[model samples]
Target: MNRCLSTLAKLDEEGYSAPALARLADRRAFPPRLEFTRADIMEIRTRTAAHMSISGVQEKISLRLHRGKLQPVTEDGEYILKPIPGLALPRFQEDVPANENLTMQLAEQIYGIHTAPNACIRLANSELAYITRRFDRRRDGTRVAQEDFCQLMGKTPESAGPLYKYGASYEELGQALRKYCSAYPVELEKLFRQIVFNYAVANGDAHLKNFSLQQTATFGDYVLTPAYDLLCTKLHLPEESRLAIDLFAEDEEPESIATYGFVTGADLLDLASRFGLIEQRARTILNDICDHRDKARDLIARSFLSDEAKVVYQAIFDERLRALEIRG
Candidate 1:
């Protein structure tokens, strides 16, 4: 019997399980095979690029789950579909979708980070694509007011230059959250845990545009939106920067990050201090994050990454864990 790629459950001839299908939509059958080809997706991407608010090198098309089947749409999309990109020349491009799917699942299932609902689905060519239901959209198709850190900081390519999004520190994001979010202490801890999780998984692309705040039911209140774009970028872009942004701003680095030249548990404790957390609370978070090695490895084993990719992925994971240098 084969394993269901979507849920990683034992399959009884049906490729997806009831729970996995339900995750896509209540009582939904396996999404009907996409009517368009990858080439069709490229053409649509070209025509729709100006209209889409989401940004990245990978090609993505807005989709809506209509009447139990997924269909591509140019407007008011309830889900976002990302096929293996044709650009940027990343290594092991075929594994990119599964890499993202596995990383997102690890964040949500293992570390308990709130992530956008996501899964791996088959493209028309039998290739895999990453799909996530849009958290900013409601069942009735209204848009939620959400703003990424870049926007919150009033940054743009023109204002801050080409690498604008990468120019800041995670500490700046924490400060921004403090000013905007009414529930600062609680959300700050969530942000700290997310940063630790990103390091653990080697998601080096967690930039300003990747984190956001969404308006809540209280009219003016805001909170961190569910995590999106979570992935092990090191697997694809091995030679790229270790992190999209510095863990701390200049003049704020602890001796550990300054001397050792990478993040250590000490540096994280310093960051938590900068975020106004007490030392003991920070250590507890770090210890808790460090204790999840076996669970992460088990999920990696069950993921859909190719055998070669899986080995590289685990190697990256182990190396990042060592770099963290968690203490007693």
Candidate 2:
């Protein structure tokens, strides 16, 4: 684990920052050369002993050859390795530190929402690397059935619009949630917390693909995966033309802000009702999120972000939390 961390840190030092990789070019620094091989991949698979194969090309997924005894990857499960791409990194350079910071903060926030696996290692390579424990695996090594939100709702990755268009409407999603979730107010509260955390962190990228339902044969149903890929992209990026995705049954137009755009408190209330949460419970969830604004602010300040970036983050945090009127 120490070696892995050291290697990642060295990669970041050599200029493989997230922004640089997103932009696909080195800006003020050069990236280090870390060798990834088939043998190393095999070792990672054997040790973590998870049976899975790399399935996509948009991002590269490799097995970790030597992760020590920490068992970074889950037992008999695969791990995802997203190397920072050269081009995309530079495009998002200014926001890199903030994005990374948000990822860490999000992991903590989700602890209050649901049982998310730990995401401790973030690589500073040509592209920002996010490693996560694969939850869609059984104790023995069978791949539990899993469906990307996009595919489940009959959409493709590329066809996904600027806003998230690859999934079912909020109404449809709510139905699914009710079927899969614990059907308790406490669980619903956690879901609300997740929504608030995303908005508070300015994670404009929380589209359908970002969240998914995992189908476990043992459990005989689908459930939300512990949150993964939780990062703040809006703070450093330019204003987007659309919200992450429409949450209610609104016009199919793009939205500027996620919360206020098509989905309002009314929409949230509707969804909550379907999920078995009463209006007051929903309000309580909002209030709890609002109360955490200061904590979010502090987390941003403590990150490796620049001063200018920190101020930007603070401003966004204040505006969003205040708009929602969340109280401690």
lDDT of each: 0.82, 0.50
Where does candidate 2 stray beyond 4 Å? 1-58, 65-77, 88-101, 107-111, 115-128, 138-140, 157-167, 179-189, 216-218, 250-267, 270-276, 326-328
- Residues 221-282 of candidate 2: C-alpha lDDT, one tens digit per residue: 56666676676666646575224655555544323235354333444555566566777878
Give each model's clash number: 0, 26
* Residue 119 miss distance in model 2 (angstroms): 4.3
What TM-score fits each model?
0.93, 0.65
TM-score of 1: 0.93
Please report, as a residue range, the 10-residue window in candidate 1 with the lowest summed lDDT: 24-33
Q: lDDT of candidate 1?
A: 0.82
Specify the highest-TM-score model's number: 1
Candidates in order: C-alpha RMSD to true structure: 2.0, 9.3
